[model samples]
Target: MSHDAAMSVQHPQDIDQGHVVARYVSNERRYLKLLGGGFLRLGEAERAAFIAALRADALQVSPEEIGALLGYEWRSRLTAAWLVGVARRIEWRERVGELLLASELTYAGQGYCFALAQFGGKNDAEILVSYLDRYLPHLECRYDQGLALGALLRLDSRLGTSHAERFAVRDGLWERWVDALPHTRGTADAWADASRSRIDAWCNLWDA
Candidate 1:
């Protein structure tokens, strides 16, 4: 899916009840996508509203709802992961870690990475390491290695750990991964940019 595609706001009545994000109001769903950074065309006022709405909605989302969202398809799972980060739901760390390691769906791992980065603990660091450990070897996979590495690097900065050191060395996994990309930007730039947007979106929710 094109991340830059313009997403229309759905009305509460227009949204299907079976949709993973349908539990949230239409505006919340729209803002959630904004938070996801897949839709970048928003005014400042809408951005502020997205942050506030996400903050309020995260608190209201239940454990069961979150679990179900994670169990659902990529969009729901993505939203669930973002909510986990915004709410700082540490209890869901293991589950999100499992999903991150699984690398089940496209784009969803970005959310998982963001959640782990928000949790920002040794275990989360280990999970990111495990992800890099698993996927970095298979250059053909081309999954979330960049996002995982970026998140791990961010966590290492906060935790003062060298977890990302081996992967990021000269002509190391990081270099290999970047070179393997078909449409990669500068080294680590794509990962750093996307990860920053994801973290900043949820962090702003908390800051609000």
Candidate 2:
């Protein structure tokens, strides 16, 4: 059967059930189908449900599942990135470490790295800083580094001597991010914008 035909054969009720299953299955294609079908249509309740499922002990997906989604060639990188965002919301803090250890540099990894630095606690911040210091030179997506910088700035304003020094360094660090902004996928804009706004607020707080 043609790919579209196979998809059409899935019962509507099965499709909905599949969404619930996909949330727990730890399979990339299943996740792709469910997320692709439901991402745009998800209301706050559905999102909450998805998060709850993700957090359930019975549904604890493996790091390999996340790695596969991050590395999947046919999948939407942005969608995978958004999944990482969801993972962060589900309080999978340790998973970010797995993402950092994954072999490939995926946009999903980039987004997760940013989320780690943003929502992560002190240990997460330290890990992110170490990762950046180690990997920044080799990464092609320097914009992600900029996003990481923005996240770090938000994580601790006092990491630097003063807020001014932090902003100055962050401003310089974000130049690559600013240059790459025009080329990023539209779906990534929300993460990028949130990163920017947080950094901006930090700068403004010190300025005021």
Candidate 3:
């Protein structure tokens, strides 16, 4: 699929099961379908919204059950990875990050690295950085370093707009970011401090 085609997918907001927490406890069939494929095979946006809605209101349920969705099946596996990577729950982060890191699937690794950068601390960031260095591709459509950098900036604002100033996305940022920019690096650092100059130099190319 073209980047535009891949990104056109929207969240199935119409499928809201009213009070996401209550319905899960009631064992609603639609909830399972929402995660699986009821309306029309949950797309990235739909899955992301499902996770966000659940995280926002479904705080009472067992995270393990919610966690199970990640590996329930390969068809929706990316959705599960999205849940693991973006969930605010610490347990989710730890479990998913570790699992994704070891996964033979590199696509999942991108999301895993992003989550680490968002919620991880020093060690987490280091792990994320090392993983990116070892696995992230240098060619276009495969480089997702922007997420790593964005996560670090989210973690530490001191890095400043200097980091995003040159980002090639002049119009905006959205789902297609993974395929929009061509970023490749010879090395990476979890702590912006260790590779301060290099990061700045690399980010400088955002405008180039």
Candidate 4:
């Protein structure tokens, strides 16, 4: 046999082992894309299988590879955070921290912070708190702050709420916002106007 052909050959027992080597451990975009439309469109059994396979593959990837996802597209970032959270991938938590610090404070950034909370212990929560301390002053919109606060509450309830005084909109206000979010649905412009009005009110309250 040619050397290449010889290398390709495997014993029956070795075939299963060889298949394992071919399995994906990273490149999340590729795996999720290969699932066709997305995980949500899959049937129940297939979705579970896909999730299980992704979890297994996530666990196999190096911390560095997982960390790299902090800088990737939103889907990849969310996936990385989910994997880190479930796997308790402590070694990669620093990368999540970088995401928190570098975040643009948009909806996408809020999701990144939310996913990051799933990864570590008290110290990780503390890091977020500290970051928020610095982040609060320059914040212009309430949309992202609402998401960040919710994640912090998940992290450490007492500590997170302790900082509530610094927020212009209290939990009660957010509760009201959620109640109001659905009413503006029929018109996109109405939705935007209402959202802008609420955001402005929150900003003005904080500024005052």
TM-score of each: 0.79, 0.44, 0.41, 0.51
lDDT score for candidate 3 against the true structure = 0.41
Scored against the true structure, residue 57 in model 1 reaches a CA lDDT of: 73
Better of 3 and 4 by lDDT: 4
Instruction: Give residue 186's error in model 2 in angstroms.
Output: 19
Q: What count of clashes does model 1 give?
A: 0
Task: Identify the runs in model 1 with alpha carbons over 4 angstroms from their true place.
Answer: 1-20, 25-36, 39-41, 182-208
For residues 109-207, write the lDDT of model 4, one tens digit per residue. Answer: 443454445543676666666565655554342434444554555555433444433432443433333335465323433433443343233222212
Q: lDDT by residue for model 2 over 65-178, one digit each (tens)?
A: 444444333232333444455445435556555455342433444445544544546766675565555444442444245456556656665454222233234333233334
Candidate 4 wrong stretches, greater than 4 Å: 1-43, 71-75, 104-111, 136-143, 157-208
Whole-model Cα lDDT of every candidate shown, in order = 0.71, 0.44, 0.41, 0.47
lDDT of 3 by residue, 66-184 (tens): 55444433223344443444444456666655544444443444445444543546655555444344433433444334445455454344423333322223322222333344341
Cα lDDT of model 1 by residue, 176-197, tens digit: 7777766763556556556555
Best by lDDT: 1
Q: Please give the range of 10 consecutive residues that has the lowest summed lDDT in model 2.
A: 1-10
Error of 2 at 42 (Å): 2.4
Q: Rank the candidates by lDDT, best first.
A: 1, 4, 2, 3
TM-score of 3: 0.41
Say which candidate scores most in TM-score: 1
Candidate 4 residue pairs in backbone clash: none
lDDT winner between 1 and 3, please give it: 1
Write down the lDDT that model 4 would get: 0.47
